[model samples]
Target: MTSTVRRAGAFAGVGSLALVAPLLGWAAAVPFAVVAGIAVLVGDGPVFELFARPGDWEEGRLHGLIGFALAATGLGLLSTVEAMPTLAFVGAVLTLVYGNLAAQVVRRRSTDPVVGAVGFVLGGAVGCWIGILATALLNGDSGVAPAFVVFLSASGALLGALLRSVLFERDDPVVVLSVGLLLWFLWELTDPGTVHDVGIALAVTVAVGYASYALDTASVSGMLSGVFLGLLTIVLGGIGWFAVIIVFFGIGGLSTKFRYEEKAQRGVAEKNEGARGSSNVFSNAAVALAAVLAYAAAPIHLPVGDGTGIAGGIFLYAFAGSISTAMSDTLSSEIGGVFDRPRLITTLKPVDPGTDGAVTWQGELAGTAGATLIALVAVALLDSVGPTGAGVILVAGVAGMTVDSLLGATVEGGRLGNQSVNFLATLSGGAVGAVLASGLGIAAVA
Candidate 1:
């Protein structure tokens, strides 16, 4: 059989098992288990080898198929659909089958990372739509909205694509299995948000992300990360919170262009002409993202402040502080390049402009300004973060920027990468903000 026919047949065979699930319930695992066993026993056999890429058979790729069966069986055992285990089984099986098939179609089109990511996202949505339709038809009701399903499935697929990029040699089916299971868990177990909220968030994030990409302020992965983070931010905290993140990104990106030609001549310009990527985005935003998640999970009442004050105030402080730190650090490095000689933070000896630990008075001032800008924005937008809270954010940002310099001078070039230092700086900023909030009795922990 041709490769296309083989693929179609495999998808069909696995998908057909969903029908059996409604009848067999837990027993539906038998056929998949038998296939897994055959694959394991045959390891390098022709049936497995026929579809394997170079080095795949040598890595015992067939064994990876076992994960699919295990995932479906786990879903069958744990989740319920319409209070029926059998229908849940059908959903899991169909999700795995369709999601993997769609991912395969995506992977075949290009080797470019951005193309693969875009394809995976679109494919995952299509797969979820199909899975929902199939389940609704087979079981007479799906009990889920297609829009939310598509959103969750796309999120899963994005993760799968990122994982595949990191673990490039892993079998695609195994990666898709993870996506399938996650989509099911998200759809069944969690209350992410309403479809209307998700839809608006998605639309806004995509529009902003595309504009950023077009402006060449962010790379492909940077744009993707922005969309993902923006969507989550809007969903959790609303548009006001999302605006803070965008402001940081916008100002930070623009900072790199300040006297761009001079910085380039000095060999201190950011790589890729100041276009940010995934590593840069995550490093700066990791703590802020954590704070966002914490805000989402915060309790209705806390030990300090009246009613709502302490409950959500602490996370807001941390979020503002972390974002402030990111902006501060970026401006310090970028604007510092055009100033007079910079001294090494550790030795106080003049060094090259771009030296990891270099610092200048102009740069320090610029950093302070950047931090203040973020703090002001936070205070203006968030009712919970008043002037006092903004002060804490400003202090945290400067403190984190100092910590980053110290780390860079001491350990960054040797033991830690630049991204690691950036993450630590943001983390320190968040911690400082939280501690200051507690000390001030704004949001003391219980």
Candidate 2:
């Protein structure tokens, strides 16, 4: 057989076997074969030149073995436990193998086997842990599958890093792997039983996909922000309030990306290129604390609306507020930006759409409606809101917005940085929302 035909046959055989690994109970072996086969076919020619001088066989083999092991371990875990469909695992493994080959093929190839191994191990461990937690928490299923998910996630990330590095030499594999693992961990935490595993998985996938894409695009700050938010959300849970905060920050990041790209073309807004500044931390913390206190102080009653338990109530309201706040900010900003006219938040005078501390009539109305909708939806989803809860959310949302405006116009703008301001504003708005809801007897005063 011709060399080309032989190579093609080998590749085709690997692909077919990969597709049947799960059914055949050989998921672990697929990654190993693919990695080794690619290494053999690619020869050690470039690998030797890159990592070793003319007579350095020891260095060359060590490097190849390290790369192969890392790649195999990652792919094996992802396939076995993550329960990723066969196609994805196969594709990921193939891509990484090809990437390793390409990297070696390059003129100035710089492959760090040690760094790659570390990334593979760390990323794989984190990914597996997250997959296990998510399956246990969300699916309530118990099995020995999480190990595979971790393996696959790690493998995909390692391959992703290598490919990124080869294509974009400045790209750092360790950073990418770390960020990817962190995102997976956060995704797992938010996998509440109430939500479908598929939905949660999709969200997690989007987060991971975005992180990878950002790395590829060389948006390091964006990637970091995505990782940070993912971690924060996981730490906070899938409650409405935290979701809202995520949405707000997510939108802000997107807005900044758009602006940066626009300015890149125009040679403007270069220095301001980083994560968008926001004031969500204080606001979220205050809101969370208030919810906790209110739930603790209020009369604990079972079947209050839908779920029983003080924890449930707190989660309900916090999630509600988070969603409301996030939507309010997004709708206001997006709509306000398009409105023919916008006004400063402190004053009713016209101002630019993107101006901080600015609010247009259109924006205010949009924001109010957005927050109210989120609250109402949350109440309905939880089946907690009676007529009273509905009314409470309306009142609380308006009150929250009012407080948000007040804080934004005064304390938020006074001295604190953007993060501080967001935190304070979210806290104030959430506190006001909770207080108003409780006072009005809309949501069991919690």
Candidate 3:
């Protein structure tokens, strides 16, 4: 069949789901998922191809369809209240259908990649907003506030646009599925008091993400992941926690640019002009993010400290340690590689500047400075961590940086990628911080 026929078929198939979604409620996800799975095994042929763009991978189409089926079904189950289920179902259905159509139009009309990206993001937001509003009018209630609607729109746009590119424009269903799941989570898990903070968190995250992209400090995927992380920090850990991550990003970017021309000539400079990708961002921040989540979920507060007391002391310390380690490793690699002669971490033998496991006195000092700065930020902004806790966090960060070098020397290329090493380093940093803080009876208050 021609592309037009395929497109029409996809539209009809997805649109048909929207029409019957009210009746199916949460049960709508299974049949389509089952069909997509069977299509994957037997080969979708025209069935999957109809949802795929030109030159798309055949295998990815199957995954994409399956993801959409799950998302569409899952969204409807977001609330158990009467009319809320149908409202969510129709809103999701129209947002996705209309958003997909808008993206197609923009792609055909504009060859500029920037234009295409903006169109896709804005189109999806507009689609979701319109869908939600229209559904609210018809259903007489959306069971959510206006701010939440905006948040949902933003979430949908970011998830769909970013994931599509991150996944290489294949497996588009993953994007759909992620967006749906995230929306459901937000709807269900958010505290009522946090409703006021939601808008600011989103605005700040988006603005910073755009700035990072414009400055050439972050790739598209990097920006997306960073924004997601930032939003979580602000929403879960509060703006103070978000500030620590921002400081790390700023410091990391500045460090990358330090002695850039010389580092480039020496062939040790970061690729793509030091614009970080998704892998780099995630690896560096994963442990810190986990710490933030744990802090948010802590049920009891310790009585020893002034603020969050024990829980705050523990998780905030871990968050600080992770961020400090990431910054330390980044600065060490970027600045240390430029100023001093390097020695292998394992044998202290002379080595090239960019050699894995290379270490230098200057690099170690730079890493220490980076760790100190992050720990200081935690001390200043977080109520739970004082001078003593900051000291422990700093120590943990330095330890993690040491671990990174040792790992790099021992098993970097053989058993672990650079990103994996970074992740382990951050994880070690957080773990060490948690241990020390708990042992010291530290208390971190919100």
Candidate 4:
């Protein structure tokens, strides 16, 4: 606990520096940088939690000193190379702090080299990009402006809290609120917040979530989580996208219930009848949620503006792939049990019905049909996918399903786990769709 406090303090200080880059130059950042450096350099305390070192005085002090030196060197380099040295320094310092912190924290979390490497790459990329942008913003800037400092500080703290929640500690309501507030902050940056818009989004999320629960589409816990993710989708994807999510819930929920007794007799029924829990929803929709975020971040040529144009955009393409893949997997799994015989994917030997990694011709066709159905629906409503994009979605969905089977036969339930595999399958499908769209010249470079 003591260490947690100290580590939190250090992270807070680092976050403050990063958050202030746009509003306050290094003039305002230098002191906080010093504080963060000192926090990291603390010879004893929670700082050691991150670096995966035993909290021994001798070893701790050496690591602390190294961390401090790295930070100082980063700041120095930023000041030398950037036109807006103050902002540049702050950005560079933040990049160093966040990236290194993420790498260390990830190392502590996982022994897997792949996981650690992925963490490092993502954290470093975000840090460096933010730093470079700050440097560019500093061009022609003369003095520090006090305006927006308070707001930006809060935003910074929110990000800090989020980093800790995701990477270091458990989730908190405060952190959740921080996410909402930051999202609100971003939304308000474009225009004034209207009660109508907020009310409608909330109402939609509540209605759909509650309806799902009342209708036994999900459990109570599932409803709560669904509301959260659903509301987030509204914020990120808008009403049209939210509609697609609902379609999935309604259809998938019904399918799970269909012939539930028969499936149960075969010992292939879904847990809790047809009702799903939070984990199930997340496994299916998380990648789609990420796709929505990626889409909103950049200006893309959406298929909505006109029927004939450049591709609907990477976000649209990826979202389609993700959703289609998830639906395909679901339909295939649920419908496959009706087939009397299944073949093992690896050896092509006959396997018991519903065996892990087993595939059937009937299941494959059902899965492809499901993907095509979802793709067509997206095209009709979202207006963001072309025929080519839809085809890519279908192909990727099939690929994701096949890969999921391969994984189910191997790493799943051992190293990767089922939920993790589901997320990966959707992610793989999204990636495939993205690549295919790009290769086909359907999506423009963003």
Error of 1 at 189 (Å): 8.9
Provide the global lDDT of candidate 3 against the true structure. 0.72
Instruction: Evaluate candidate 2 by giving its C-alpha RMSD to the native, one decimal.
Output: 12.2
Better of 1 and 3 by TM-score: 3
Global lDDT scores for all candidate models: 0.70, 0.44, 0.72, 0.61
User: Model 1, 1-446: lDDT tens per residue?
Assistant: 23633553474465556565545544655666666666566656667654444444567665445555555555554433334334334544554455445555666776665665666566545554565566566667757665566566556545555555445433545554565555544444335567777777888887888787777788877877788778767766767789889999888987877888899999888788888887899999988887776676554323234433565667877887888899999999998889878999888999887788899998899999999998888778776677887899899999999999999888987999999999999999888988898789765322
- Model 4 segments more than 4 A misplaced: 1-194, 300-312, 444-446
Q: Which has the higher lDDT value, candidate number 2 or candidate number 3?
A: 3
RMSD to native, candidate 4 = 10.3
**Residue pairs with backbone atoms closer than 3 Å in model 1 (clashes):** none
What are the runs in model 2 whose C-alpha is more than 4 Å off?
1-308, 338-356, 386-391, 394-397, 411-414, 442-446
Error of 1 at 205 (Å): 0.9
Off by over 4 Å in 1: 1-33, 43-46, 57-115, 129-151, 169-193, 259-265, 300-311, 444-446
Query: For every candidate structure, what is the RMSD over all alpha carbons to the true structure, in angstroms?
Result: 4.6, 12.2, 4.7, 10.3
Best by TM-score: 3
The pairs that clash in candidate 4 are 3-46
Q: Which residue pairs collide in model 3, if any?
A: 64-173, 307-445, 308-444, 308-445, 309-443, 309-444, 310-443, 312-444, 313-444
Tens digits of per-residue lDDT for model 3, 1-446: 33634463375356445544445545645555565566456444666566655553534555555556655555555433333444445545555555566666677777755455566677767766766566566555756677777767766676666665567544555555566555554554345234467777888998988888888888887887788788778877877799999999877976887888899988888888988877899899999988876665554333344434576567877888899899999988998888767999999999887888999899999999999998888888877678988888899889999999999999998999999999999999988888988888774454
In model 1, what lDDT does residue 90 have?
A: 54
Consecutive 10-residue window with the lowest summed lDDT within model 1: 299-308
Q: Per model, how many backbone clashes are there?
A: 0, 30, 9, 1
Candidate 4 residue-wise lDDT, 78-148, digit = tens:
44454433433443345435544565577777875334434443464355445444544555433323222
